[model samples]
Target: MKFVGPLIALMLAATPLRAEIDITEVTSPDGINAWLVEEQSIPFVALELRFKGGASLDLPGKRGATNLMVGLLEEGAGDLDARAFAEKAESLAASFDFDVGDDAVSISARFLTENKDEALALLRDAITQPRFDQAAIERVKAQIVSVIRSDAQDPDTIVGAEFDRMLFGDHPYGSAIEGSEDSVAALTQEDLVEAYKGALARDRVYVGAAGDISAEELAALLDKLLSDLPETGTPQPADIEVTTDAGVTVVPFDVPQSVAIFGHEGIARDDPDFFAAYVLNEILGGGGFEARLMEEVREKRGLTYGVYSYLVPKDQAALYLGRVSSANNRIAEAIEVIRDEWTKMAENGVTQDELDSAKTYLTGAYPLRFDGNGPIANILVGMQMDDLPIDYVNTRNAQVEAITLDDIKRVAARVLKPEALRFVVVGQPEGLES
Candidate 1:
């Protein structure tokens, strides 16, 4: 925690909450694209990079390759061993995070502006020349296997895994990114190398930077840092329409409570009605305590402590998903209430009051996202990935405010399908039948 205070001060002292954001799109000399938010007040910079087709790019029988590869990035790079890398980063007061998901590999970094060149060169080594030493591989592999063992015993993980199997069939989305313990233990140095190549190529990369940098400097930095990556890697997996098997699929475990994941297909991110669907989800289950599902399942009936639902629009597919937990004997009623609310929302939609409240809250909360340079950079990259216009920050609130009550009703009817709602319950619930 010794480093926490300075990082905090670096970000908050030049906060840009409720201020105009000027985004410039820059194309590096090597044809890499990046979004930049120049905040020169602080001698700090935050950089974010994403490579699409993340864990999904794993080769046949090589599940977890991308995940494992990402974990090894900072372990050793160029001539530095893991300890040397750690000491160097700390000496420079820099931080780096490497992560992967089903759709993308993400890297986030922050360093003092004065140390930009050194920090970037170090990062470039990690990105382009990871050693993946034999010892580090074994050590990280053991850690991942440990997590797989722990996840096996967790009800939340158990339920979600079963749900994905039912929902995605043979698609990569059906499998865990962590892979199985056997698959991970079998991974080789070559597999990690292939995984790294497939994941960090320029063709699928998106970059965003903020704080203490000029546009020309950022462009030059991008070229120097990323020019070594391959132009292309493995091809993305085929797109699959969601598999909706609408019924309760019970994975009975001896537990005191029942955890369930439910929902069906969802709208895409680029849909013209996406905002409407977002607003509708907030009204239905995505919002705080005032959301309809919470009002019905927790506030009124006391079936569970909390319930939440969100729209998942992935690069390959989309779905509306939610989770709830209750005492084994009571989860059935909770599901019943949730289903009822879903049907009601589809049929009747939201009232003007709900619409107005959601708009106000959604719009008001939007600005909080731009409070600091790190978040601003993250937002910029996400916007580029989502194919949003550069002026999106300025126009987003207006779009949310533009949604009408009729729009919500139409999107609700289109998105929520009660008959196709599948619930995967993991536990021993007395009165429930699959």
Candidate 2:
């Protein structure tokens, strides 16, 4: 579908600064609910679906089952084989993507309005009636197993796996989303089917749609696409505490560069202090070259090319985490610098300049993300997942702007624990000991 001048004007007219995004809360006749943003001029629709409790729903001993099932969804479905499914989607000028993450199985579809029915029918088949053919299963399994094998040897992967294990302990979050070698190798067709049933269910689903579709049309589409699924999934995993202790653990690897992942417990997304912590994080590590970690570690000392930190709020737990790579000989100094910065931030808080700059960048960069139909759809779904209000897009910057220096100082002291910081360093660094 071609977008002419009128559509182009409509698209560019709503800048992020204007807070003009009008999001409609849509409820279908069949009782399905979704978020929608109608843009009729585009003559296309972008639909985003998320089945919450994603890989976390993997039953005991079926670690990578959902991951594999997600890959196979588009590989074959209903009467169509893998090749036939690809050909069908291509012929319809539709795009379908299925992916499984730690928290959700995300499916995205884009279809021209002219072929919306056919495209959605194909997508529905892929979701509700995936064939999971043996040949296709083996092919996709081999691909995932290959990645698992590769990740096993990668230093960064090793550090992350060990970090999760150390922090989450026996919780499902500790396990790799793509399952380990033995686990993936042992996953059977029955396991995949069971995983599919447990992961994709009506009660746990969240959806967002953008582009040419209206609320009424989206309601019907929602029911048509997902109504066949079971209403509930199996019991979800329990909430976990980030149990990482203060100190460092060095896994000796024969490499020239050392990779470190460090953090402690983090504030929840809904916490009153979350906005303050968010701004503090941006000043500390999330702002790239302008951030404290970057300026002190990389730009000043040349300890590494990059260093970063972020708040990871999962369904099960929340964490404040960061990563950095440095020459094995210089890693100890880098770790000390990171620890010192953590202490300084926790004790001193950020200045007004830093806070204002963070707010500007955070607010300015947010609206740019809604540049397309698909991204808007995705964002809408994500806001729902985060339990954000319908008018969050308009109000998000105000929340950032309201944070004061005292707020950052108070939240930093509460959330950032310098003594509790744990570093998982992978590589044989000269002067550091665990």
Candidate 3:
């Protein structure tokens, strides 16, 4: 009954999607920097701000302070209570989203050109003057606890958690950013205050803005929006060299299908061979139906309904991870096939046909990511956080196109480690053990 699936297929078959974006760098008089893309066709603006050192900046033993504090940013700020703040934003026809990841706290705002100033003022107050009232704290805490409980009951979450614990041990990456129920229950107002000061500061902010704003106006707007924040935040987390034990760790769950997550040490984003590694992963596992893992495990053998792998180049560490799920009776066979494909990719590398296909798919799909001003704004911020140059959007495809078979071979030999893959399977999997 859904036409969306066929409509997308028809549209994609009609033409290759691509974006032609021009980026301009702007700097505030007070020294804040941001990327700007002017699009006068729209009467709205999308702005994205990223503060590095997100939930990872939680003080020792305070696992979810930053996340909880971020949740409270719009609950109330200045004199406005939660409902009043929501009404104010609704009146201005503006939207704000605050999210925290392991590495950064992200704030995204969209507003009409007519309401830019008022919207920015409301957003600024939320960033700098959160109330964190005791009642709001209890409410958001309960919500977070509820989410944690829900996640605890998910088989996929169980697999990922177990895999991370076995791989990263005591590192912050090993745990969920949501914090445990006990941790969330124990957080005090003082802890939230400390987390806010540690995570949202001027020194680590990256910004991107698009639509309805010029360079001069954007530079002024940047200073007005962020100049009063704290000068610095908590220090960044230390680097970690990830290592994985080669085997399976099983957590029994009452399910008919077994869910497995596997990973090993991976290349850093800044490494020279990172582009090659990315392409290699695409050919080996991430290129959807065209990937070798899918061709072998799903097409030829029908071991599972789906399988995939990806490169996770985190700020402080890197991991090559993958996921697969299959009937409990066939889960062991699926794992064996995935491992065999992994070894083949590392030993023999990809063919020229695969390299070309991956390049074309990657290049063609990238432009689809810029489908809207909001996405463009978010992309700009992400590029800034990755330390990519302003021209990366224009040059990224060429980089992918220029990769050759030899580059894939070398990167495959260096980055892929079949023997080091660690898997955590959750289910009552038959013929498989921890």
Tens-place lDDT digits, model 2, residues 148-257: 98998899999999999988776779889999888888999998899989999998899999889888899898889999998988767889877667799999998999
Each candidate: RMSD: 1.3, 2.9, 4.2
Report the poorest 10 consecutive residues by lDDT, candidate 2: 9-18
lDDT of each: 0.91, 0.89, 0.89
Query: CA shift at 90, candidate 2, in angstroms?
Result: 0.4
- TM-score of structure candidate 3: 0.95
lDDT per residue as tens, model 1, 103-197? 99999998888889999999999999999999999999999999999999999999999988888877889899999998898999999999999
Q: What TM-score number comes out for model 1? A: 0.98
Error of 1 at 3 (Å): 4.0
lDDT (Cα, 0-100) at 59 in candidate 1: 85
Model 3, 355: alpha-carbon shift in Å? Answer: 0.9
Candidate 3 local distance difference test against the native: 0.89
Give the winner by lDDT: 1
Clashing pairs in 1: none
Highest TM-score, which number? 1
- In model 2, the Cα lDDT at residue 128 comes to 95
